[model samples]
Each structure stands twice: as C-alpha cells, then as structure tokens.
Target: MLSWALTFLIIAIIAAVFGFGGIAGAAAGIAKIIFFIFVVLLVISLVANAVKGKAPKV
Candidate 1:
C-alpha cells in the first residue's frame, strides 16, 4: 500500500513537470489517501501486537 502511494506520488511529480495539472492533482490525492490509510493500519497493527504481549514473528 505504501509502495502504491509512492508510485502515485512519483507519477504526480512527473505529471506536474509535464504541465498535466489534472493528472497531477488526481495522483497526489490518491497518494495522500493511500498514505493515510497505510499509517492508520500500521498503528492498529502495532497496538494489536502490544496488547497481545508477544513479539511478532520474523
């Protein structure tokens, strides 16, 4: 999910450089949503692991 966000961010930058305002805006918006979702999921996973009182399997 994070990688997808990064991919979209790169796309946005390239699009912006090429003067594609619409595409850049859309990609950036998608990247933002994905990034936030990733962060939220990560936090939830961490809390779940802590509450379980066990180390994550490597």
Candidate 2:
C-alpha cells in the first residue's frame, strides 16, 4: 500500500513535468489518500500487537 502511494507520487511528478495538470492533480490526490490509509492501518497493527502483549515485528 505504501508502494502504491509512492507509485502514484512518481506518476504525479512525471505528469507535472509533462504539463499534464489534470492527471498530475488526480494522481497526487490518490497518493495522499493511499498514504493516509497506510498510516492508519500501520497504527492499528501496532495497537493490536501491543494489546496482545507482544512486541511489534518492526
């Protein structure tokens, strides 16, 4: 999921370089959404592991 966000970010950069305003904007928005979702999921995983009385794997 993090990789997906990065991919979209790269796409946005390339599109912007090529002067594709709409595509760049859309890719950036999608990347932002993916990044937030990834962060939320990561936090949930850490909390769940802590509740289980185990160290998070990393």
Candidate 3:
C-alpha cells in the first residue's frame, strides 16, 4: 500500500516535470488516498496487536 503511494508520487513528479497537468493532479490525488489508507491500516494493525497482547515481531 505504501509502495503504491510512493509509486503514484513518483508518477506525479514525472508528470509535472513533463507539464502534464491533469495526469499530475490525478496521480497526486491517488498518492494522497493511498497514503492515508496505508496509515489507517497501520493504525488498525497496531490496535489489533495490542488487543491480542502480542509484542511486535522483531
């Protein structure tokens, strides 16, 4: 998920450099959504692990 966000960010950067306004904007939006989803998933995983009384795996 995080990788996807990063990928989109890279795409946005490239698109912006090439002057693709629409593509850049769309890619940026996708990056933002993916990043937020990744954060939410991480938080959920942390909460679940805490509830299960399990230490984070090394």
- Candidate RMSDs in Å, in order, are 4.0, 4.6, 4.2
TM agreement with the true structure for every prediction:
0.91, 0.91, 0.90
Off by over 4 Å in 2: 54-58
Error of 3 at 23 (Å): 0.1
Q: Rate the local accuracy (lDDT) of all candidates.
A: 0.98, 0.98, 0.97
TM-score, structure 2 vs. true = 0.91
Q: Mind giving the per-residue lDDT tens digits that candidate 2 earns over 27-53?
A: 999999999999999999999988889
What is the C-alpha lDDT profile of model 3 across 1-58, one tens digit per residue? 8999999999999999999999999999999999999999999999998889957799
Q: What residue pairs clash in candidate 2, if any at all?
A: none
Give the local distance difference test score of model 3.
0.97
* Over 4 Å off, model 3: 54-58
- Candidate 1 local Cα displacement, residue 52, angstroms: 0.4
Name the candidate that leads on TM-score.
Answer: 1
